[model samples]
Target: MHKYQKLNIQKLYQIYIYLTIRLLMNVMWIVLAIFLIILIFERVAERLGIDRWYKLSSIGWIFLSIYWLSSFIAYLDTDDFVNMLLTLLAAIFSFIIAFKIIIDNRKYPWKNITLWVTISILIIFPFYKIPILRDFLIDMVANHTLFILSSVFNASGEIITDATIILNGFPVSIVIGCTAIESMAFFAGLILCLNAPLKRKIIALVFIPVIYIANLFRNAFAIYAYGNQLFQFGIIGTAHESFFWAHNVIAKIYSFLVVVILAYLTFKIFPEFLTLIEDIISSFKKDVDK
Candidate 1:
């Protein structure tokens, strides 16, 4: 048996994060929904040239700040430094954006960004929480990946369950993130939230399924490499090493390149939208300089 002792507020804070983690996450999504509603109303008000509804966007931006701050704290208990740092920066940037939206004497389009974040979160958070939807995506990816391994690559593989694919003796678990939904959601929000022509947005939307197909092949390659233990050698020693090299290093680089190419394609298709992104960045930079 172990002993129970009281701790300081600093230590208590970390413990509370995971202790009430489920509640924290529920509140986070509820806040996000509220903000999404606000942003939708704000957009409508802007179109109708109304001030009161549009002014509510300041609260939406603050909700975004709170959303990311909670995400940052949730990740603090884990060992994922990269995720922690990125969420921290997101929280800070959202905080700053909220204030900028509030003191908009000159008026900026930061509210558009709030809508984008809201859409992205709406997609990611729900897909993560809702079991039926999440499982379907995971199953789709896993089954297709197992098929690719067995048929395309001529590798021996089997689907043990909806989310588990076994190649040879090793198993690979497929999560919702593996379905490329996050990437698709981001690009969906990107195409919809930005100032782009209707025709161009439709064209850009085609890449969502394209990314999913491409991700199937990427997942196939990762599973083949990791499950087959292809890199069981010096330096790249075990299953973990094979996973890191294939999934983390190689797959990540290619995935990033794919997104970059698609972004450049968007630039070509909707040239003025690039200007919109530039303005979004420079708006903050201009304030920082001042």
Candidate 2:
């Protein structure tokens, strides 16, 4: 046991030394790259004027990245005044944090930093557009799911041509923004951070449409129920209460439940899959030793 401990200690020491050298080299490269970029910018500015060059500096690049991220997130589903205000506030906070990271690292040249910044921006753009995508995908899923559900429920009515459901003279349109695309986008970021496998990440991608489709049908059915509310609203005797308001809440609740259920399933299955992977690695190591 003492000899085993010594071996482990020696292995760890070697790894530590190797990593220390790698870290030092990376830092040196970053510093050198930054200095070279700044020198080039300074020379260019000498000919182009200080003001114009300053606008294209490391600081300016950070500001642009921050602005782009903030503006993109801020633009999603700003329908409700309260939601619009909240999104704007969140965008501002996100920008500040991202900006600080870049500014604090401004010792590096703009060019070296651009790769990382640009890569992040590219990654985030698709997710930022998810709310909009959810709307369209949800509507498609909901409308189709409603048709299926209608068949199951043995309900009879003209299926409206667009994404609208008409019942008892009440028509409700399933807007794409009403889908859970935004929430899935948020969860996608979390899963990505967890370093989930490509297959598992693909599962999350699949869940987006599943959640959206479930939401779409939930909305459609709620509208159907709203139209047939002679059974439900008869208890309240509508003096023109918010048409479909209760049903809208129901649909939203159903979508939330669906998201929770899918997320839970993903979490459960992913850990088991990881365990399987670990087992495989163990088997491979044993084979190598043999």
Candidate 3:
């Protein structure tokens, strides 16, 4: 009887955690739009030199950071150590910036952060909630990924109409994140918003398609790695070590470096954007020196 009660408590705790995480994730999606609007207004106010806007904007930033904090807590449950760490770091950065804004509430700082983060989130957030758009992108990614796996890699795989790939007895579902839509959206939004010439913007925006193709290849590689049990050496005593290494660690590091490189290349094409970034840093540093 005692064991039964203890088991019930454990299951109840799991359910509570699951519900809390899902609730937080859902709220973040809804609030993404709110933050984008606030930041857009703040950006305009900064351009107009309205110091009063900082008061409202800084508060909004503090509130908006709940998204990152929530994500950090959610990843703790999934055992995604890398993502959990990254989200914690992001939450810290966001809160630090918010603290600075609050301290120097009248001073106009975070201009570039206002520009880039808002644009990126605005572009990326909608697709997550919009069913048709999410499904379309996920489906396309799964189709091409499976096709490349079958033809180029000579891997055996079949995609369920529901966007799951059963490859080499490993079933991996292709979600919207796997489609690389977020990164593509971030790149497209940043380039389009930059104060660069139309020609330069066009050139930088070309990276979007490049990113899409690269993401397709990345997904195929992950499928190959997992399906072939490339990292299933059982070193971690997990039967799914192949997937954990491929999708969580190796693929993530590769994707992060690739995005950083692509963003750097875009900066080279947009000198004004780089200057804006430097100015944002200077603003933060000035507050720190105070």
User: Which segments of model 3 are wrong by more than 4 Å?
Assistant: 1-26, 29-50, 105-109
Per-residue lDDT of candidate 1, residues 1-290 (tens digit):
22343346657888788777865556656557666677657667778887656456566556667777888898888644555787889888877876777766544466567667677777777778888888888888888887888888888888886588877777888887689988888888878887777887887889899899889989999899988777766684556777667776688778879989998987888766687778778877887899
Model 2 residue runs over 4 Å out of place are 1-139, 178-194, 230-244, 269-290
Off by over 4 Å in 1: 1-23, 43-59, 66-85, 233-237
Ranking by TM-score: 3, 1, 2
Alpha-carbon lDDT, every model: 0.76, 0.53, 0.77
- How many residue pairs clash in model 1? 0
| lDDT of each residue in 141-208, candidate 2, tens digit only | 55675675577555554457566666667766655454555555555444454444777667666765
Per-candidate RMSD, Å: 6.4, 21.4, 7.5
Pairwise lDDT winner, candidates 1 and 2: 1
Worst 10 residues of 2 by lDDT: 105-114
For candidate 3, the per-residue lDDT at 196 reads 72
- Give the candidate number with the greatest TM-score: 3
Clashing pairs in 2: 34-109, 135-176
* Order by lDDT, highest first: 3, 1, 2
Per-model TM values vs. the true structure: 0.79, 0.45, 0.81
* C-alpha RMSD (angstroms) for model 2: 21.4
